[model samples]
Target: MPVFSGIWVALVTPFNEGAIDFPALRRLARHLLDAGVSGLVACGTTGEAAALSKDEQLAVLDALLDEVPGDQLVMGVAGNNLTEVLAFQREVQRRPIAGVLVPAPYYIRPSQDGLLAWFGAIADASTVPVILYDIPYRTGVRLELDTLRQLARHPRVVAIKDCGGNPETTLALIADGELDVLTGEDGQIFNTLCMGGRGAIAASAHIHPQEFVRMADCIANGELAAARVIFQKLQPLIRLAFAEPNPAPVKSLLAMQGLIVDELRLPMQRSSPTLLQRLRAELA
Candidate 1:
């Protein structure tokens, strides 16, 4: 299995006039790659996957793949529909991706046994490795430590995007050394890495990606002081990226950089004016 270490950006999908912006998407992927992110995750929560159509999601994945090496790309596979999710997984594996980031079935909130079976089935069908996404806040269910341990034993289940919001689970997973624990929460990146996390799939990395990358390297190289400085400096930016509901705040900042238009699909709106002002000050 490939080591999923360093800073992997949970990329935000770019939009223009309420449609998928392929050109902007391509540029954003190249920008992050050039800035030296370890990898790129497409259609993840940060990308607003819930809002994108199936075709749009695939297009976004293809756009990233065009700029990123297959080994450095992971596509997010989410939804409560098991059959549909599995079918999508089959199609996603056809590409030479690093792996798939699969969250638990949302709204259904399955039991540990169900969680195990759900992920096991996906792993069984996946040609590539599976990175379990344990984000209970969004999915409405937690992958208990024991359940995670069971999943760890699966040969194809390699890593996890640890957003369970429980420090105990995080530490235990690190100590167990069964799965590579990548921090999904941007604010927790430094502590997670210091606690022996493999890396981060950070949405905050969309801006100043090199800093995030450098911080990870510093931590890995035992430069705690340097890493601390970087993390402290980035705290405000990280907080601001998520001040609003996700990509809204993130996309606003990106728009200020002329990277993409400040737009989002309905049901999801743009960042508030106050937040936008703060973003400008922070970027300045």
Candidate 2:
């Protein structure tokens, strides 16, 4: 495994006037790196991967790679089409990424066997390690524990971004210990870490990233009281971040900080006025 531990920010793609804001993206990547996140995940759900064209995604990756080391970057890859996904994987593998974060094929809702085959084939083709993304809610199918356990046998399948929302599954995966369990659910970071999980791929960390990092360190060092206090302070921000559809409230807060313009692609809008008020209050 490539030590996919600690807080890895699921970076939002900053847009400006309907275009990918490369400078802002670079600045944000540098900011997160300066704040001490373990790594950055570009083109993930938080980054609005679905909204970006292949060229735009690669450009974003390029900008981030320029700012952050390749080992400190994980690129998100998802699609219902296996061939296209594999081809995209081949294209991205040319860069020295830490690994590719892959979700099960969306929309089609493949059987466990199909899921195994899908991830296995991608894992086989990928030169870098694979971080299995078990976000069933977005992908429309769960990567069940048994299926995940089966995938663990693959030499290239090294970690999991767990958003399955099942504590039993989370506990099982941690107990199994075959994969490094990094919770994708921001709110679960504290609990997941306490439960013997490795780290987080948090969207909420974008706001006060150092606190998220410190919280994880506290838990890792067995300082539960300190970790609990940090989590309590961060709870409100996490709630507000996801209050709107992801990255909206996140981008809103980031824009307020002047990190990026608060823009998101259409179909995905900016944070609502009500939530913006809350975010402002929270940031204040």
Error of 2 at 267 (Å): 0.3
Runs in model 2 with CA error above 4 Å? none
Q: What is the C-alpha lDDT of each candidate?
A: 0.92, 0.93
Q: Stretches of candidate 1 above 4 Å error?
A: none
Clashes of 1: 0
Query: Among all windows of ten consecutive residues in candidate 2, which has the lowest summed lDDT?
Result: 1-10
lDDT of 1 at 90: 82
| Per-residue accuracy of model 2 over 1-284 as CA lDDT, tens digit each | 43689999999999999999999999999999899999999999999999999888888888888899999999999898999999889889999899999999888988999999999999999899899999888889999999999999998899999999999999999999999999999989999999999999999999999999999999989999999999999999999999989989999999999999999998998898898899999989
Clashes per candidate (backbone, < 3 Å): 0, 0
lDDT of 1 by residue, 154-226 (tens): 9889999999999999999999998999999999999999999999999999999999999999999999999
